[model samples]
Target chain A: MYANRQWVLAQRPAGEPDLDCFELRETDTDAPTDGELLVETRYLSVDPYMRGRMSEQESYAEPWAVGEPLEGGIVGEVVETESDAYDIGDLVTGQGTWGEYSLLAAADVAPVDPSVAPPEAYLGILGMPGRTAYFGLLEVGDPAPGDTVVVSGAAGAVGSVVGQIAKLNGCHVVGFAGTDEKTRWLTEDLGFDAAINYKTTDDYQAALADAAPDGVDVYYDNVGGPITDAVFTQLNLDATVAVCGQIAHYNAESVPTGPRKLPQLIAPRATVQGLLVGDFATRFEVATEQLSEWVAAGKLTHRESIVEGLSNAPEAFLGLFAGDNIGKQVVQVAAE
Target chain B: MYANRQWVLAQRPAGEPDLDCFELRETDTDAPTDGELLVETRYLSVDPYMRGRMSEQESYAEPWAVGEPLEGGIVGEVVETESDAYDIGDLVTGQGTWGEYSLLAAADVAPVDPSVAPPEAYLGILGMPGRTAYFGLLEVGDPAPGDTVVVSGAAGAVGSVVGQIAKLNGCHVVGFAGTDEKTRWLTEDLGFDAAINYKTTDDYQAALADAAPDGVDVYYDNVGGPITDAVFTQLNLDATVAVCGQIAHYNAESVPTGPRKLPQLIAPRATVQGLLVGDFATRFEVATEQLSEWVAAGKLTHRESIVEGLSNAPEAFLGLFAGDNIGKQVVQVAAE
Candidate 1:
C-alpha cells in the first residue's frame, strides 16, 4: 500500500483557470493486480490542451468532471508489476493520474530507456509533443525544400521541435515566441532562420513579411489569435496550414471572434487542416525512432521547465497560458 | 466594322454596387487581325464571382479598374476569323468583352456544339460553374459514400450542382437556400435529402442539426457568414470543406469579422480548402465530358434566369447580390 497525493478538479472554470479550480487530496493506493503496474510518479506533463478538459466544452479530449481526479501524461518508475511486459525498477511513460502513485494497465504504458536520454524526455521531445511536431508538420504541413515554414508558439514544446524539423528539411524556418530571450534561443540555439517576439512586435504581418519575403509556404499553428490572422494574410499559393493547437482561445467563455479568413484563403488556394497526434498512433514507432536518432546526433535540441513537487502541478499548468515556460512544462513529483 | 454596345466600369464600388457603377458606351469593332476572330456575342454570363472584380480588394480574380470595359464569359458565333482553328458561323465560348461584338484571339476560344445542349447552356452547367462544382466537390471536398454533405448557398449556380453530384455519389445531402421556393426546388426537384431556408430559419444551427442528425461529413461553402458559422459547429470527424466561393461577403467594404473557427476544427480535425476552377484548367475537358454525359442522361439538371439585352447586363449582375435570380444568371445580347 502507498499513501498517495492526488489533484482533483474542484470546479469548472468559466474563463482562465486558477489554482482555486484544483484541490489536492490524500488517497491510498493498493498493490498492482493482473496486467497492472504500480508506478511512482517522477514527472507529470502539463500541456495547453488540458485547458479544454477543465471546462465542460466538447473537445478532442473528454472533459474532466468536478471533484474527479485529474489525469495527464506521466513518466514514472515501476515499483511492482503483475505483467511480464515490465519488471520492477523499470521506467515507463503513459497516460496516468496526477498523483504520487498510479496503478496503470501494462498495455497503456510503454517502457522508456534512460541511457539515450533522461526519463522526462519521454514527456517532452521524445514523447507526445515530439511525435506531434513530426507528423503534424511533415504529413500535414508538407514543407518542401526552400519553403518558408512558420510556427506559432514556437518556443514551446511542440513549436520548438517543429521549427528544427523544418530547418532539417531545408526550409527557411521562422517562429513566433512571446519573449525576446525565447526568440533569440530559437534563431541561435535551434537554428531557426528567424524568430519574432510576438509580445513586443506591433505588426505581425510586417514582421512576417520581412522574415519571409517569399511568403509562408507552410504554417504550423500552435497559437491561434491575431498571430494566426496575420499568418493567413501572407500564405503563398497552395500553402498548407497545420492546425495543431489553438491555445489562444482555449479559455474563452464564449466563442471568440476574429477576422474572417475564408476570403483570404481563396486568393492563395491554401489548405487549413486541423490535427490531433492520436490519429497517427499506428505510425508512432516511426516518429519515435527518427526523433531518437535526431536527439542522439545532436541535430535536435530541447529544454525543460520543471516545477518541483506534486502540489505545484496546477501552478505549472496555469503558467502555460501566461507563456512562462520556454519549452516543455513538467512537474517533478519525486526524485528519479 | 460592327457597331458595339459595351458596359464599362464607371467607378469602383464602396459597398454593395449600385447601377451607377456601370456605364453603357458605344464603340466600333474592326476586322480580325492576324489570329483574332471577330465574334458576335450571344450569351453573357453574370456570376457571383464578378462581385470580387468590382472591388479593389485582392482576390483570386483581378479587380476591374474604373473606366475599363467589363468582361465575362461569352458564347458567340464567329463572324470572321484569321486562324485555321475556327471559321465563320462557328459557335464558340471563352472569356469575351461585354459588348455586342468582340475580337478574340483564336487560341482563347473553344468551339461548342449547339446540339449537345443550348448555346446558353455553355454559359451555365456545361461551362465554368459546372466544372467548378465537379472538381471542387470531388477533389477538394472528397465526399465518401453515406457522407452527410452540407452546402451553403445551395441554390446557386455551383452549389445546386454540388448537391446533385453528392447525391449521385451515394451521399445524404443537405442544403441552405435563401427562400422556401429555393428550398423546395432543392428537396423536391433536385433530390436533396433536406434543405433549410436560411432566410426564414431563425436558428441555422438547430435547423442543420435536425436536417443532418449525424453531423456534416462534407461541406461545399458558397456562402460565408452566419450560415457558414453554423455549419462549422456540425462538422464530423475528418470532414472536408471545399471553399468554392463566399458570395455573402464579396461586397463588404472592409474585412468582415466572424466567430473564430480554428478552435471548432480541432475536435473533428476538419479540413477547409479554398479552390479556384483555373487551378484545374488542365482537366477541364474531363469535367466537361462528364457533366455533358450527366446532363444528357437526365442525371443532372440546370436552370438559367436570363435577362434580355446587353443593356440589362449590369442589372443582371446586381440582382445576384439580392438573391433575385435562381441558378445561373445570364444576359442575352442578341438572338441565336
Candidate 2:
C-alpha cells in the first residue's frame, strides 16, 4: 500500500470553474494487480476539453460526477509491474487519475522513449494534442499548396502545431492569438506568414482581409466566437474548416449567439466539419512517428507552460480559459 | 421586329422587396442574330434565388443593377432560328430575358420534348430546382438507409424533391414548413414520415425531438433560422448538412444573428456544407434523366403554383417570401 494525494471535483461550475471546484485530498493506492502497473505521476495534462466533463451536458466525452476524482493524460514512471509489458522504473504515458500515483493497466499505457523527447512531451507534443493538429488539419482542413490557412487560438497546443504543419504543406499560414507576444512567437518562430492579436484587433474582418489578400482556403478553429464569424466572411471558394475546439464559449452559462454564417457559405460553398482526436486513434502512430521526426530535425518546435506541483493542476486548467498559456499547458506533479 | 413587355429593377430593396421595386415596360426586339434563336416566352420561372440578384450583396449569382431587365430560366417556343440544332416552333428552355421574346444563342439553349413532360416542366422539375435537389441531397447530404433526413422549406420546389429522393433512398424523411396545408402535402402527398409547421410550433427543438426521436442524420437546409438552430441540437453522430438556400434571411436588410452552432457540432462531429446547383452543371443530364424517369413512373410527383400572364411575375416572386406557393412557383407568359 502507498499514500497518495488526489484532486476530486468538489462542486460543479456554473460558468467558469474556480479553485473551489477542485479539492485535493489524501488517499491510498493498492499494489499492482495482474496485468497492471503501479506508477508515480510525473506530469499531468490540463486541457480545455476538461471543462465539458465538469458539466452534465451531453458531449463526446463522459461528464465527471461531483466527488469523483478527475482523470486525464499523465506521464509517469512504473514503480512496480505485474505484467511483462512494462518493467519497474520504465517511463510510460496513458490516461491516469489526477494524483501522485496511479495503478494503471499495463495494456492501457505505452512506454515512452526519453531519448527522443523529455517524459513530459508524452503528455503534449508527442501525445493527444500533436495527433489532433495532424489529422484535423490534413484530413479535415485539406490545405493545398499556396492555400491560405487560418488558425484560431494560434498559440495553443493544437493551433501552434496546425500552423506549422500547414507551412510544411507549402501553404500560407495566418494565426489568431490573444497577446502580442504570442502572435510574435507564431509569425517569427513558427514560420506563420502572419499573426493577429485578436485581443487588440478591433475589426477582425479588416485585419484578416489585409493579412490574407487571396482569402482563406482553410480554417482550423480552436477559439469560436467573433473570431470565427470574421473568418467565415473571408472564406475563399471551396474553403474547408476544421472545428477542433471552442475555448471562447466553454465557460458560458448559456449558448452564445453570433452572425448567421450559413448564408455566407452558399456563395463560397465552404465546408465545416467537427473533429475529435479520439476518432483518429487508429492513425495515432503515423502522426506520432512523423511528429517525432519533425521535432528531431528541428523542423517543428513545442513549448510547455508547465505549472509546478499537483496542487496547482486546477489553476493550470483554469489558465487555458484566461489565455495564460503560450503553448501546451501541463502540470509538473513530480520531478523525473 | 417584335414589341415586348419586360420587367426591370426600378430600385434595390431595403428589406423585403415591394411592387415598387419592379417596373413593367414595353421594349422592342430585333430579329435573331447569326447564331441566335428568337424565342417567344411561354413559361417564366419566378424563384427565391432571384431575390439575391436584386440586392447588391456579393452572392454566387451576379447582382442585378438598378434599371436592368431581370433574366431567368424560361421555357419558350423558338419561332426564328439561325442554327441547325433547333427548328422553328421548337419548344426550348434556357437562360432568357423576362420579355415576351428573347434572342438567345443556339448553343446556350436546349431543346425540350413536350412528350416527356410539359414545356413548363423544363422550367421546374427538369430544370435548376430538380437538379439542385438531386446533387445536393445525394452528393452532399449522402443519406443512407435507416437515416433520418430532415428538410427545411419542405414544401418548396427544391426541398419537396429532396425529401422524396431521400425517401427513395430508403431513409426516414421529416420536413419543416410554414402552414398546415404544406405539412399535409409533405406527409400525405410526398410520403414524408413526419412534418412540422414551424410557424405554429413555438418550441422547434421539442417538435424536432418528437419527430426525429433518433436524432437527425442528414439535414437539407433551405430555410436557415430558428428551425436550423433546433436541428443543430439534435444532430446524430457524423451527420451531414447540405445548405442549399436560406430564404429566411433573404429579405433581411442586414446580416441576421442566431445562436452560434459550431460548439454543438463538436460532440457529434457533424459536417455542414454549402451547395449551389450551378456547380453541378456538368451532371445536369444525369439528374434530368433520373428525375424524368421517376416522374413518368409516378414515383415522383411535382406541383406548380402558376400565376397567369407576365404582369404577375413580380407578384409571384414576392409571394415566395410570404410562402404563398406550395410547390414550384412559375408565371405562365403564354399558352403552350
Candidate 3:
C-alpha cells in the first residue's frame, strides 16, 4: 500500500472556510478491489462549488462529512487495474478523494484522449464546467443572432467559456468582472463586445444599459446579488437568464437586500432558470466533441491557474470564494 | 349622432387610484363608416391591468390619455352595422372604450354564441381573463400530473380559473387568498386541494409548508410580493413559476426588500418565467375552445361580480386593487 494524503472536513464554515475547517492527513492508500482501479492523481480541479459541499445546508449534492475525505473532480492515471475497462497508465478523470491517490470504480472513471487536447483540460474546458457553459447557455438561454448576451463573473472558467460560446452563436456578448485586468481580457482577448468592471462602476444598472443598448436578451448569471439585480433591470422582453452559480453570496454571513422587482418579470416576460451540470451527464460526450472541435478549430480558448502541490488544494478551493483564481483553478499533484 | 359619455384619465395617483383620476364628459359619437360597426356596449370588463395603463410608466400597452375614454374587453350588440362581416342585433365582444356606445371595426370583434353560454359569461369565464388563466398556467407553468400548484390571489379573476384548470390537469392545487370566504370558495367550490388565508396567516411560508408537504412544483404568481416569497421557500426541484401579475406590490411607494434566496435556485434547479396573454393572442381561440369545453363538462367553474350601470364602472375598476371581485369584475352598460 502507498500513502494517500487526504483533506477531511474538520468543521462547517460560517462565512468563508479556512484551513481550520479542513484537516489534511496522510493515510494508507487502498489496493484496487474487483471492479476498482487505483489512480495516482495528476491534477485536482478546485471549483467554486466545493464551497457548497463543505456546508451542511441543503444543496444539490450531499455535504462532506467530518473526518472523511473531501471529494471533487480529479484527473489521474490508472496505476493498477482490477477491471477490463481501465488498464495501467490509461488517463482517466472522475470524482475522487482530495488526495494524492484514490481507488475508484472503473465505471466511474472516464478515459481521455491526450492527442486532441492536454490531459489537464479534461478537468476544465472539456469537462463538467465546459459542458455546463455549453448546454446551459445555448439550450436554456436560447440566444438569437444579434441578441445581447451578458455574463457575470466573466473571468472565471464557466463565465469565460459562456461568453466565448455565446460569441460563436452570433450573439453580441457583454461581461462583468471584478477587476480591470479581467475586464481587459474579456473585451480585448475573449471577443466580448463590452466588459464592465462592476467593482469600479457606481451604478450597475446604468453600466449594463450603457453596455447593452438593445437590452439583454440572454443573461448567464454566475455571480448573483447586486450584479444580478442590475442585469434584471436591463432584460429585454422575453429574455432568458441562466442561473448557473451564485458565487457572490456563498460566503456571506447574512443575505443581501436590494430592490425586489419581481414584477418586472411580468412586464418584460423574462425567464430565470437554474442549471446544474450533473443533469447533463448523459450528454458529456456530445459536449466534449463540440467543445473539442471548437478548441481544435482555434474558435475557443481556455485559461487555468495552476496552484502547485496537493497540500495547497484546500487553499485553492477556498480561494474561489475570494475571486482569487483568474480562470479554472487546478491543483497540480505531480509532473505528467 | 349619439351622445357618448366617456371616462378620461385626469391625473395619476400616488397609491391606489381614486375616482378623481377619471373624469366623465359627454361627446358626440361618430357614425359607423365602411367596415365599422356601432356597438352599444352592454357588458364592459374592468380589469386590474387597466390600472397600469392609467399610469405614465412604460408598459406593454400605451398609457391612457387624459381626455380619452378608458377601454377594455367589452361585449355589446351590433345596433347599427355598416359592414358585411356583422349584422344588426348580433351579440359580439371586442376590446372597446368605456363609453355606452363605441365604434369598432367588424374584423376586430367576434360574434358571441349566446346559446352556449350567457352574454355576461362572454365577458368573464369565456373571455379575456379565462383565456389568460388557461394559457398562463398551462403554457408557462406546464403542470404535470401529481404536481402541486400554488397560486397567489387565488380568489381573484385570473387566479380562480387557474386553480380550477390546474385541478383538472391532475395537480394538487393550493391557493392564497385575502378572506376566509374566498379561501372556502377556492377549497370548497373551486375544488382546490388546499387554501391559505394570507390576511389571517402570520407566517405564510410555514403555513404553505404545513399545507403542501410535497413542496410546490408550479407557482402561478398573481400577487408577487410576500405571498410569492412564501412560495419561493417551498419550491421543489425543477419547479416552474409563472409570473402572471403582481397586483399586491403594484401600488407600493417604494420597492420592498424580499428574501434573497436566489442561491436556492441552483440547488432546486427551478425556473421562473413571465407571461402575458397578449403575447399568445393568436392562439386565444384555441385556448377559449378548451376552456369552454372544460366549463361545459363542469370540470371548471367561475364567478363574476357584476356591477350595474356605467356610472359604477370606476368603483368596479377600483375594487380590483382591493381584491373585492370574486372572479371577473364587469360593468353592465346596457340590457341585452
* lDDT winner: 2
Give residue B248's error in model 3 in angstroms.
Answer: 1.4
Residue by residue across B175-225, what tens digits does model 3's lDDT show? 999999999999999999999999999998899998888999999998888
Docking class of 3: medium
Q: Is candidate 1 or candidate 3 better by DockQ?
A: 1
- What digit string (tens of lDDT, one per residue) describes model 2 on residues B132-225? 9999999999999999999999999999999999999999999999999999999999999999999899999999999999999999999999
Q: For model 2, what is the error of residue A223's alpha carbon versus the real structure, in angstroms, after optimal superposition? A: 0.5
lDDT of 2 at A247: 95
lDDT, candidate 3, A1-336, per-residue tens: 887888888899898778999888879987998999999999999888888888887588888888899898999999999999988999999999889899999988888888767888888888888998998898888898899999998899899999999999899999999889899988888899999998899998888888899999999999888998888888898899999998887887776656675777888999999999888888889998999999888898888888999889888987887778776899999789
Each prediction's whole-model lDDT (CA): 0.93, 0.93, 0.88
Worst 10 residues of 1 chain A by lDDT: A51-60
The worst-scoring run of ten residues by lDDT in candidate 1 chain B lies at B56-65
The worst-scoring run of ten residues by lDDT in candidate 3 chain A lies at A253-262
Instruction: Provide the TM-score of chain B versus the true chain B for each model in turn.
Output: 0.98, 0.98, 0.97
Q: Which residue pairs of candidate 2 clash? A: none
Q: What DockQ values do the models have? A: 0.84, 0.91, 0.71
For candidate 2, the per-residue lDDT at A239 reads: 99
